[model samples]
Target: MTKSISYRFALCICVLFSVANLSVADTLTVTWTGAIGELETTIMADTSADGTQAHAVYKLESNKTYLQRSTIVLESSCDIVGAAYGTGETPATIQPIPGDDGASQFAGWPAGNIKTYGEDQSYAFKNLLFNGVFADGSTTLFGVLATYGKGNTITVDHVTSVHNQVITYFCFGQEENWTLTNNTAVQYSCYPAGMYFGGFWWGGGGGWTGTVESLLIQNNTIEGAHGQAFVIYDNGLVNRTEGEVINVDHNTFVNIIDWPKFYRHGNNTRWTNNLFVNMAANGQTRNAANTNIALNNDHVGGHGKTATLYQGACTDSTLLADGNCWDRTNRNISYQNNAWMDTPELLDMFAMEPWCWDLPADSNGVVVTLCDTMIANQSKWAGDSTMSMFANGVYMSNNLHMSDRGWNLDPVYITAQTTRTRDWLDNGVHDTHTDHFWMHQADGDKITVEWPLPMDFSYLATSAAATHCTHGGPVGSTHHMDHPAGLTLNTNPDGIVASTFALKQNYPNPFNPSTEISFNLDEIADINLSIFNMLGQKVRTLTNGTKPAGVHTLEWDGRDEMGQRVSTGIYLYTLSNGSKTITKKMALMK
Candidate 1:
């Protein structure tokens, strides 16, 4: 009996030790450290029915890519909350710190703060790069919250999400409805909107009437988004009991189609200190109660100043747009203390006065160089590879080489050294890296066209003797061409390949009898080059067969499919392979 009791006591001690070890093991930790790409993490509650804590950390080295198609997903029914950590506001100020590239730089949410509230969480991402995304692609790359509980807080700060074509970074309200006042989104990169607040249309759900309160969006740089920076709409549903109090401030937006627009919203929607450049259309359209729009500044780039303010039909009288710096007029809305400082063309286009008829008139507003306001720092003027700086001039370098120090239309290549330039003596040949030429629209037209230089003639041919000349055939030859690798025919002994596919503007555009339509193919493919009249009727078929890729030219004799010359008018020439198609317009002066 004594021996048996001793054995039982020993077994009890072993059981207790195992239980203690299991308790400590319940704490979960997930970590990912590597180059930029897709990442995922899943955490579940301990099986003991006791709420255990789980922690996750992600670290990236550096990335210069965009539209990465990377994803960080966190799916759980347990408690999940997170805070972004790092500082990456100015690239020059920060010396590209090792181990952290993207997580810390943005325009929104306070820098370093951690507050947790949320039940059954999804993902939190930081320090990443993306190339581009599409609408039909995996829309949810980050997180999809399936359940909602009270006092649940989700925080996303100090994260840079850039160059997504259409997919939103984060999505809420899919399976069950939940109210969240502790959720925060800030400091993102280029997304359709920094954040989208609505129900998933394809998820077979009705509208989301969940309350999202005290959400803060600030201090992020966004550009190249095709839709509004932020949108909260439920199929235009009226009074369905969804509440939201959003604060959008201190963000930089460029090349945006629309600003933050709210069709169905709650109270206390405020937008301030947000800088918008190269806006394609309207700024803000908030038709909500207690809506305060103030101190928002904007500039329309080369695209026309069609930005509008259409609050004229708001039923809520509390909607006030005051102390903003946009094109404000009484044409469609009631506004005050707003200012307008557009170009003479914009001034004539709008035909509205500078000052709005509201209290605290906009006396401090004035027009300045649009580029100056964009760079934020004058020292970062030319060398900054991140943002494009627009200019209009031609200057000579220290070597007496003429250079076009003006806008390079391609935003992807912004560094001063990489920008395209034309030397005065090059006969029309441009540098290898340059994509556009700074030229007057016409012989006397002062406005520069930044016309895309011909790919075949654009690059400089450098021989071993350091002699530089145009790469293509004799300067005036129409077939000066380079074939993309697979597009070249086996007959060419030199085995040269084309690097890019392009359709050049037809030369001698107003030719009476015939004109040359030129294009370069990068790869061999079945092609269909056809001409269509302004009325969308196929007037002539240029080529509809397999063609070896190189720079090829076809003579359109200004004739129709019936082999008869058509009347003088405008026509569109379309170039289509099996996968891609492009169109260009031309005029025939018969």
Candidate 2:
């Protein structure tokens, strides 16, 4: 009996020990130590109810690579000084003492921070940081400093960095599929950028000369170091030498005066739908073929009077080059009903990069300053090769400088917020970014030419209708051009695109009592207009048939096919041809 009791007690002790160990293993903390290390974590997809990836583990070591196909979380304290724990270097670089700087207790300090390896491995990062390489007097930090041949993918979210020399890039160098969203980057250097902003430290080894190809810079807010401006450069060295595509959309460039310098947005890069205020493109003239529309960017207006607002000079005109084939390119480009505001007092709009589509102009001789500019050109086949200034210039009523803008000619009146101003350049006062401009018609009325109603299409044609004899320029400073002769751009809002199909917002969105929706078909086509609820349930069908395209309006009574009223908090309306479908959201009020 005594022997049996002893055995039972021993077994009980083992069971308790196992449970204790499991509990402790459930939670793990990462910190700096003498040795470089990696914390290998397992990732199981479909563990969550939705069958999407539910959980993952990350392991990385100080000064040692975590290898590829791995993810690790590098965290720093909210304190400015605590940022020191983020980088692989010893915290002594920023905080020589435990609390000397804003460094926090990571259970392991600077020595414990980890680094990653990307080449010949699959690696990714989610919610990571590389922080604190600065003097106690200042914080210098970097986030992720990537250097390697392109391998795997990386993703970072909510990555924050202090504007310090040492702890700079929250996520620095990158290659391949990088999706960085909602990140806050603050840099403070004498020159401001310190080491964090650019991956310059990555050196020249791994094709490090140029910007990463196929990178998406989306939804990020970057604040340049004080006194130091930001410029997005095209690194000549990249994995794919030809046809690289980088998309810089939905991102905010704040306090960054000079725009990215390279004329090519990485071979076939896209710069669209971004907001640029209080900054300038800094003389960066992008080519239409190489760089997509420099579209829908707003000038903050506050910088209008300062030299900071002037974006360098147009040193490159890739858009005008022969490879662009200009109109012959048959390239697909579009605008999303974007808005720009310029006051009535600023002139010299020609200095800005040319917008691919037509811009606003003033009727009634109401001169307006340009918020943006573009020079349309004829197709390469036309052999003229000059930018057609898509507006008519009346030198005291001489249409000699007139170029056609193809949009619906209509009588519309919407007063500009900024009153007309004189242009100092032409011995005429200029307008700000917001003053109203006109296109074909004066006094808000479309020019009637005894032609078809939609003949005033946004696409300018010199009678062939197959070609767009472009809107030329105050061009390369020399202002040399070859087009339909004497065309010049005025501050007009009737630039071709919007006038084609004015897709107005639905009334009483989330609505009832019948809301009116309208559209303009450039030509006849089979079309279907539909309304759907948030759940993707079909709520209403407005129009479905073959119709001549000009301008047409339809009404939705917030009712289903049977004309029965439906409840709604939010609904989506979709328009479709046989092949292309576009859906936009609308709300119903009652």
Candidate 3:
């Protein structure tokens, strides 16, 4: 409890309160004496230009550091928290100010250390410690920028960022909710020289389209070099507006350099129960120019070698007739129960050889026939199977590929070596190819986890391979590491209750005008709930009645049963109570 006794207990509660009868949700602690701009002059003197005193709550004082010479322009609805000086003190940092180079002191293109502005605001950055470097260190492009707004509600809970090229950007909103929970991002610098690092960079780019009604990247932990641990850009003319969601759940992601890049377009994307480790670890130097390439080169291991857990793309055929493309027959993307591992030294550095390219000898040594016809048209366009892109209305279940070096990480033979497939793992009506378990066919042992990762990046809860890869029971990222313990210092993290009889999965799931479907009952049940489509029929019927005994939420507005609206793709809801039934799937992207 240092920092001069937490700044003399926040100056003894501001000399026993009475700063003109504090209100607007009180709290204004700000005690960083070594100030430069003094936290934007105490948040512009508790902002209130018409945001009705902007619900102030600056706080920050724990192990003090705040300097920040420029950006901090939040303009309204506030709550910056971070004062609890107890369990291991620290946290209260906010860097930049010594030779400040916050991305060249902002002139354009993402430059923030806290930048939000107007519109429907709500911002909150709890237990702060964003040290994106500066104060004589370097890097720092953004830590909380909230790219212009429209219904904002941002919330970077338990914040921690380190190098930060982008740790929380949020963009072009229309409904916006973005909540990066239990945050920790540690992006190893590659800075603004050629962008891309992100540990939470949301959608809608330049031309700024809209819609983002919710993007909760849960239980965050993201680590190293991260060329993507949730970039999800959009703006090909934006789609999914009926409830729009992008929930990358239960995150943990370690040596990241891939997986979660989903640029160009998206819709109801849900990569659930996440915990990928060493994914593409700088796949041959991320923005590659052959930085010593050779991890068994064939461009180092099969299928897009690392960045494909649905890295959506679209080369504008007028934005694919405006459905804005990521079109898994209209993006209802879902990769469930995720838990990948990798590190048989990164799966033998992505093993899969054969295709030794050295080509270039033209001075009569005879190799260059235009470099062997551009290497056989790039290996026949990388082993084309009709240049694949299979997986429609995508959904893969019980995911759990592993390899703490026990081999076999086979994402369906690495997505059949290219273009994209999970063709429902060979279509026997969805998941088959032995329904996901690879680490040499499971059965136990090898699941150790501990290489610069354990400050709650947990995995060894008596691992029988993490209890045979459970999801819904334990999967990955169960949060807690940066300032955990009852989250004091203006407490925040809590809400998550619901034990037993579940049924979730349906919040903006490719939705377009409405969607919400929670469940959980463990008691007074008589439920039915309905919805069906994809030929199983039953178009709508939301709830046949009697529910009680706990959590229930229900919404669906993309109507039917006479209310109209229904067309799009994949549906199926079904909850039931007659001896318990459950069904799931959703997607309605109009």
Candidate 1 vs candidate 3, TM-score winner? 1
The local lDDT score (0 to 100) that residue 345 gets in candidate 2 is 16
Q: State the lDDT of candidate 2 residue by residue for 230-284, as single tens digits.
A: 2233332234323233444334333332232221112233443333222331212
**Residue 243 of candidate 3: its Cα lDDT?**
29
- Decreasing TM-score order of the candidates: 2, 1, 3
How many Å off is the CA of 72 in candidate 2?
10
Q: Name the lDDT value of residue 503 in candidate 3.
A: 60
Ranking by lDDT: 3, 1, 2
Clashes of 2: 106
TM-score-better candidate, 1 vs 2:
2
Please give, for residues 91-127, the per-residue lDDT of candidate 3 as tens digits: 7777765433344564455666766666555566787
Q: Deviation in angstroms for 383 in model 2?
A: 26
The residue-by-residue lDDT of candidate 1 on 372-394, one tens digit each, is 11111211111121111112111
